[model samples]
Target: MSADRGLWITLEGGDGTGKTTQAVLLAEWLRDGGREVLRTREPGGSEVGVLIRDIVLHHRGDVAPRAEALLYAADRAHHVATVVRPALERGDVVIQDRYLDSSVAYQGAGRILDPVEVRELSLWAAEGALPDLTVLLDLDPAEARCRLDSADKPFDRLEAEREEFHARVRDAFLGLAAAEPERFLVVDAAQDPESIASAVRERVAALLG
Candidate 1:
């Protein structure tokens, strides 16, 4: 929000909670409202990010928790510096699919690392760039798994993790939102996509005001 930069909004949730769907919807809605919006996602938001994303999310074998965290931090560093920051500087609203919170939730909670440490690592890696608003789509892990099953796509490395892992991730997201009420809009993802998008639009509109 410094220097009157364009608003940076991020979508976050457990797997299959419709983050991608909502990110697209939010970006579309913002554009309809006459804003130039840049839609992107973590771990693959830049030319360098694609490789990092594959390793962290699609690699065939186990990645040590610390190593995995480092990969994400590396991607985030490149992404925020090259893609997100520049877009915001140009006065383009950025609707991002994930941010440091994901690392805190997934790598920290899900991977059993200290959430605070993971958060600090990500913040340091990205030079402390944070979103103006983070929309957290809260969902039950069982419901999220069902939704993923219905999608019928091969699960990514993280998505293929046990239900317990996802539950931890979900809880971490909620905890993060609770701690930063002003920066996070906690939405019930069980609702229909249209309804969820409407709620997001309303919150973002208020922010814009």
Candidate 2:
């Protein structure tokens, strides 16, 4: 937001809550309203980031919480440097599907890692950049799992965890929104996709104003 270019908005939620779809819809709406929007997602938004994503999410082998957190932070560092920062400098409003909050939620609270430690690592990864607005699409864990029906494509390594884990992550997201009341907007993801999109569009428009 300080770059004299565009605002940075991020969409965050548990698995299958439709963050990607809503992000796309909001970006399209912003563009139609005559703004340049750069749409992207985390874990694999860049070259090295993609490999890092696979390592973090697909490696079924033993993985320590600290080490796993480091991998995620590494991918995010690349993603912000290569994709997010440059786009913002060019006057493009960046609508990132997921960002730093995911790390704090999934690795920190969901994995039972210390929040202070997670914050420290995130500070290193992100340097000074942060989102202007973070829209958290809240959803029930059972509902989220039902949405991800399949053997062909599995949930992310973090997302594939137990329901209690996701519930903790969701609570963490809510706490984050409460802690930073000005930045995060909590939205119910239980509604239909179209209705959710409409709600997001309305919130995003308000944020930009």
Over 172-209, each residue of candidate 1 has an lDDT whose tens digit, in order, gives 99999999999999999999999999999998888887
Local distance difference test, per candidate? Answer: 0.92, 0.84
Evaluate residue 110 in candidate 1 and report its C-alpha lDDT on the 0 to 100 scale.
97
- Looking at candidate 2, the ten consecutive residues that score lowest on lDDT are 1-10
lDDT of 2 by residue, 23-136 (tens): 878877887888888888788888898888788888878789999899888888888888989888897899888888888898899888997788778778878688988989
Candidates in order, TM-scores: namely 0.97, 0.92
lDDT: worst 10-residue window of model 1? 1-10
- The prediction achieving the highest TM-score against the true structure is 1
Best by lDDT: 1
TM-score of 2: 0.92
Model 2 alpha-carbon drift over 4 Å, by segment:
1-4, 150-152
